[model samples]
Target: MEELGISLSFSRPRVSNDNAFAESIFSSIFSVREWVDQFIAWYNTEHRHSGIKYVTPNQRHFGLADDICEIRRSTYEEAKRKHPKRWSRHIKSWQQPEIVKINHPRPIKSVEA
Candidate 1:
């Protein structure tokens, strides 16, 4: 790898979780809905990764990461408005249903011999 000027890093074999992010990328590559190679092609060209401000890695590679925040934030706010009521800081106790009074009288029970 060094001969080709490629730098590589390794994590401990037992600590797979340490490399989970990279492993997850590979796992998703195989598990994505579309074909792996095709998805990877599209992912590289089209999919915007959230980690790098929702710009595709290729965009970042080609120096297009600037001013993407406004676009991302605007989309985020638009999504927030569309979402259903999720929660509130102040909560009220559940109100019970209104009780209705019954006007009928109770029947007397008969004694058996």
Candidate 2:
């Protein structure tokens, strides 16, 4: 495998070796006509993923996310002011995350002294 340049994947202690994520990304392309054009368009333009605060990719791409978030924040503030009892805790953060990541490294456990 090493000579053939194929990377190996296997479970080790405390390390994830699951290939599901890597494998699932592959789309079957039987030719140009059968390619996933519609899905790709919708996924990028229309789909509002929860990870991105429910904003479409195009909105984030064009730097409109901040304005959108601010609008939502203001709306929430007004709602809170009118109906204080509706929120038991602080309003949700409408700010987009500073960074988005996939397969992010997990915090390492520190051994106690």
Q: Top TM-score: which candidate number?
A: 2
Candidate 1: deviation at residue 31, Å?
A: 15
What lDDT does the true structure give each of the candidates?
A: 0.59, 0.79
TM-score of each: 0.30, 0.62
Clashing pairs in 1: none
lDDT of 1 by residue, 14-79 (tens): 343777799899888777745777877888789976556556767666655654655655655565
TM-score of predicted model 1?
0.30
- lDDT for residue 96 in candidate 2, whole number 0-100: 93
lDDT comparing candidate 1 with the true structure: 0.59
lDDT of 2 by residue, 1-113 (tens): 65787556654433444765565554333344355777778978999867778898888888998899899999999999999999999898898987877579989999999
Q: Given candidate 1, what's the lDDT at residue 43? A: 86
